[model samples]
Target: MITFQLSKQEKVVKSINSPSNNISHCAFLACSHSPQCTTQNKTCCAYILKHSLVFIDTFFKHHNLSYVIIYGTLLGAVRNKTIIPWTKDIDIGIIDMTYLFTKKIRDELYQHGFHLFESFGLPRLCVHKNISNRTLLATYDRRHKPPASTLELKVYIDLYSMYRIYGAQTTSKTPVFLIKTGGSFHALISFQNRVTIDEQTFPTIDNIEEHLVYFYTKEYMHGIMTE
Candidate 1:
């Protein structure tokens, strides 16, 4: 029972309940990933992205990753403490110069029982696991996308790396980058340039070189996360 709190300028109805340890099959994906965001009424995924952000925040915090919600997620946290009624996805930003180490992180997630989609560098592309599965991690890859079928991605999350353009300048620009993994999907996935449709600025952390994070979890792979 998670408690739903509202932010300063809120519009969504909130429910005050304790957060649950029970995992659901949903993996928070982009707002456009589902049909519910456009429907007259919001769908379950849309509803959860608003409420479940706290859970994702908890995961990053537990992993010791200093992160802050951006885009729609941040808007919800700052304005409504809930997902915007028209929002269809969740986005979290990380600060760092994305090198070739993305694969290392993917491998680490694999050990945790998750399936790594491509090794980063893909646009509008993602990889994630079933949170509801007894296994903490599992990755289902849709490498070569066929014609009429939109990849049926179970709920997942997107992680972007932020870069600092210039250190000495007080007004140095900030931008989020997408890795180019080769091929149309992951391969030429460069900077999404603008993080959103409404804004032209990219998201960059003032201090990127110093604030990097890594997670250590062997429990999920070893079988179960024992209390």
Candidate 2:
């Protein structure tokens, strides 16, 4: 197995091959009646995404970490009150990466019925809910099963590492700032701005329209397809 090193001594192991295999089962936790929960019932998918957002928001607030909703998640929050009806996964960017993999965080997550996993160097916050052991025991092949001691994966929220870069000027008086997501830098996002959805508030970037345009071009205002 491959391990992704975060710092001098901290590392995360790739426990699961692909998280997508279990994402479909998340809708069962929300509403079990539909076999094709994601496509047949869009509300079930949105419910899972909203639940993840609320939990992560509370977790970050308790730890006093700075974060913002980005990508498709941000677009939904700005245009609609909640996540996009069709979206199966949620994306969030946290400013602090140094403290993410500490033992304290792991302990706290375990206490709250959550687990952390890493894939391709990106962290994922997974919740343990209605997923059954029997379902998880069946891995890539239905004919074979892993050890009964194997842990299960439920619905998860994707976490991206973010950093702030200062000293950039824009057309507006406000000092144009940039947020570094992975290796690329994006323009104009402030943590000071906040948006509320379903009575739950989240930190967001300023100049929503302009930032959306920067990422999605001029046609972004009308709403476009997002994964």
Candidate 3:
């Protein structure tokens, strides 16, 4: 069972219950092309990611919280006009992290049919109620178990806090900062760029080419990811 625990400051629990391994339809690998994948099924992982991002974007806007898509999620958005066919989770950076820990936000998430949980040692928000099939296939935790009576799939959205690196002190003389989570830098980004996909606009780094090159090198424009 999923445990819902909340501290005075931290509003989420440790992790979710293990999920079953009966998802034969889940490829867990990037699709050769996203256009072919998303059109096939509504409950597919790609659609799950799309819907998850839409919800978060709307949620943050409604609460007046500033956020931007970053890392692989941003890359896919800029390149494919959709999430990477093999996207396992969503990544976003909030301008203010403290707002996420308040009791009000916690209640709002729960009221919206989501259970915030920690996975991979980092906090992530997840929901299963919005999807048509009502299944939650835990992406990272695939342990064999008797099929529970609840949903069989879980879509997790990883959250990171954005910070400004004040003062320009680089050789190129442009301010650059790192988005860190769990003591590791998620991405090196600068400036803000507005991106529109499928008529839905979202914020990203203005220098997207540099952002992609900084992480994926020049080949990213061709839809190649080299870590």
Best by lDDT: 3
Tens digits of lDDT, candidate 1, 58-160: 5444555544444444443333434444444465555431321255544444343333232223212222333343322222232423212113443334544
Error of 1 at 55 (Å): 3.6
Tell me the number of clashing residue pairs for each predicted model: 22, 0, 10
**Which stretches of candidate 1 lie above 4 Å from their native place?**
1-43, 50-52, 97-130, 133-156, 171-227
lDDT of 1: 0.33
Give a tens-digit lDDT track for model 2, residues 1-227. 11222313222333344443233222123322122343223235566567667777898889988788877777777776667666645778776755766767855764665556564556676544333332321222233232121123223577776544444435554433344344344545546788776656788776777666667677765744563
User: How high a TM-score does candidate 1 get?
Assistant: 0.39
lDDT of each: 0.33, 0.55, 0.56
Task: Give the residue spans of candidate 2 off by over 4 A.
Answer: 1-43, 129-155, 170-189
TM-score of each: 0.39, 0.65, 0.66
Write model 3 residue lDDT over 9-109, tens digit each, in one string: 32233333334112332323222234455613554566667766887888888998877787778887778876766655677877666677666776677
Cα displacement (Å) at residue 178, model 3: 2.7
